[model samples]
Target: MIVITAPTGNIGRPLLSQLLESAPAAGEELRVIVRDPARLPDTARGRVEVITGSHADAKVLDRAFEGADAVFWLVPPDASRPPHDGYSGFTRPAVQAFAAHGVGHVVGVSALGRGTPVADRAGLVTASLAMDDLIASSGVAYRALANPSFFENLLEEADSIRDKSVFTDVVDADRRAPLVAVADIAAVAAGLLLDRSWTGTDSVPVLGPQDLSPNDLARIMTEQLGRPIRYERQPLDELHTTLVGYGLDEEFVQGVVDMKRAKDQGLDAGVVRTPDTASPTTFEQWCAQILAPAVRS
Candidate 1:
């Protein structure tokens, strides 16, 4: 049996599709913990058992994790909530349920930078790493899908990019960092969840084909869209003010700032992309296939 959390999310949605397609031959039974049953497609709701509630709730987790052999865990981000409450606090209950319910394997969505200069200071990444530690302490074989920035992030700025041919960020325009596509992350998660050969806890780095700076990304977008695209570098302080003005809590705002600082200081730049870690999708490919369509719409 397999239990997945955040089934309606970017990674979980795709992962559920892959698992459902592959489960028949393996005779695997699948289930999901989703807050809203309506958010799930009718096809998915019919195919798997749905436990409708937040996975962070003890009773919800207990009901969802029972009789499950492997689980896909993702702690959803809530900006108004405290870091501990959103990340580690939520995982604590699910971790207890994992031990109590005898779930043997866990595949979690985490970030890269476990052992780096800014790992301790990178706000969101620091909390995510702490969540990984809590899960590992539970004695279940775990794999944390440690990923860099996702190509999907561009969608958040697609409207601005479409209107002005520009995207903005606090990271250095010249800082080349690993930018992965979430589909690659989902594919990796589905593969690990389906196989039980590995033991103990480990971090799987899912970097994209190559490191690309914001300028590089701009150039690619220009070619793909047939228009000049530019990257506007917003100062960290200004960006912090902007997010705060949007009603985000101070801690959440700080984490976003800290992550940009860490990325600018080369936290993601050091990761070596190889056949194992390198995903097939590239920035150009994602622009043409994914981002461009969203912009056009």
Candidate 2:
């Protein structure tokens, strides 16, 4: 049995489908941990067994991990809460449960620059690195998928795109950094679960086909939507206030600013390959295929 967490999320939903489709035989079971089973689509609900509960609940986790050969784990971000063990209050309990359950293999969703110079800048990234350490200490065969920022982040500005015709961020307009699709990340993760031949603690960084900045994103957005989309760089002071105003903790806001500075200084510039690992869909393809349609109506 293959168990997946955060099944209703961007990656988890598709990852579940891909696993069920690619499994060697028809009887291969795919299990997903969900807070509420009723929210799942009829197709997914019909295909997989739904274990109801949050990832942090020990009872839910134990039941989900039981009879499971591998698991995909991730902690949902909660900026409203105070910073606790590695960005989320749930990581410690989740990791502890994985150890207690003796899960054989795991593919964890983490961030890039996990072991790099500027890793400490982002509280979330710093915490993710720590989470990976805890998982490794469990003595399970593990792979932490170190992913760059998701292109889906742009969706956060759906309202801004509609009202102002611009994309906004604190980072420099020309500071290019890699962005990967959550789909690619999910595909790589599924591949790992199907074949747990990996050994020791390892990090699989997925840098997308190219590095892009706000300006580059704007150009692509404008072209795809046939509208004048532009880049708006928020002032650093205002950026901090904005994030905090949105209910994020002060330290989390500061950490985000620090990461932007790291991006400006080119600290996030690392190239990695996922050759034969998975087929990566490009940003343009994502825009043409996903974003454009969402924006059209």
Candidate 3:
């Protein structure tokens, strides 16, 4: 049996779809811990067992982890609390449940910069790494998928791209770093969850095919979307002020600022993309396939 948390999220949704198609062939029974079962795809109904509730809840995880051989873990973002509480605190109960239920393996979604100089101070990434350590301490064979920024993040600026022909970020226009598609992350997670021959706790970096700067993204967007799109760099202080204005927790807002600063300082530049670490799907391809449609619609 394999249990998947956050099955309706960006990464979990695709991971669940892939597992639905492949797990049955491997004689694996699937289960999902979700807050709202009604949000699941029509194809998932009557196919996998559904455990309704937050996976962060001890009772929910206790039931979900029972009889489970492997688990696909992804924590949903919670900006109402500090980074540590949002990440590690939300995962503590599940860690205890993993030990009690003896779940053999786990694959978690995490960020890049594990051993880099900036890692310890990268706020949210630091908390996420600590969460990985907590899970690994449970004696489960764990693989934390260390990833960089997502191409999908640009989806948030769809309106800006469509109306103003511009997108904004805190990163420098010329700072090149790996960026990935969430679908590719899901593909990597599906492979690890299906084949559990690997043991021990380690991180798998899902660096995309190439490194891209904000300017490179703008150039690709301009070409793929058939328009003049430009990159606008937002000041770090302005980003923090904007997030705080939206009423997010002050500490959580600070976490975002710190993460952006670390990325600017090369937090995500630690990993070298190899065939093993590099995932398919280029930024230009994602623009044509995903972003273009979103902007047009």
Angstrom error at residue 61, model 1: 0.5
**Which numbered prediction scores highest in TM-score against the true structure?**
3
Residue pairs with backbone overlap in model 3: none
Question: What TM-score, to 2 decimals, does candidate 1 have?
Answer: 0.98
Question: Which wins on TM-score, candidate 1 or candidate 3?
Answer: 3
Tell me the spans in candidate 1 whose CA falls farther than 4 Å from its real position. none
Candidate 3 is scored at a TM of: 0.99
Q: What would the TM-scores of all predictions be?
A: 0.98, 0.92, 0.99
lDDT of 2 at 27: 52
> Between 1 and 3, whose lDDT is larger?
3
lDDT of each: 0.90, 0.78, 0.95
Q: Name the best candidate (by lDDT).
A: 3
Task: Output the lDDT of residue 81, model 1.
Answer: 74
Clashing pairs in 2: none
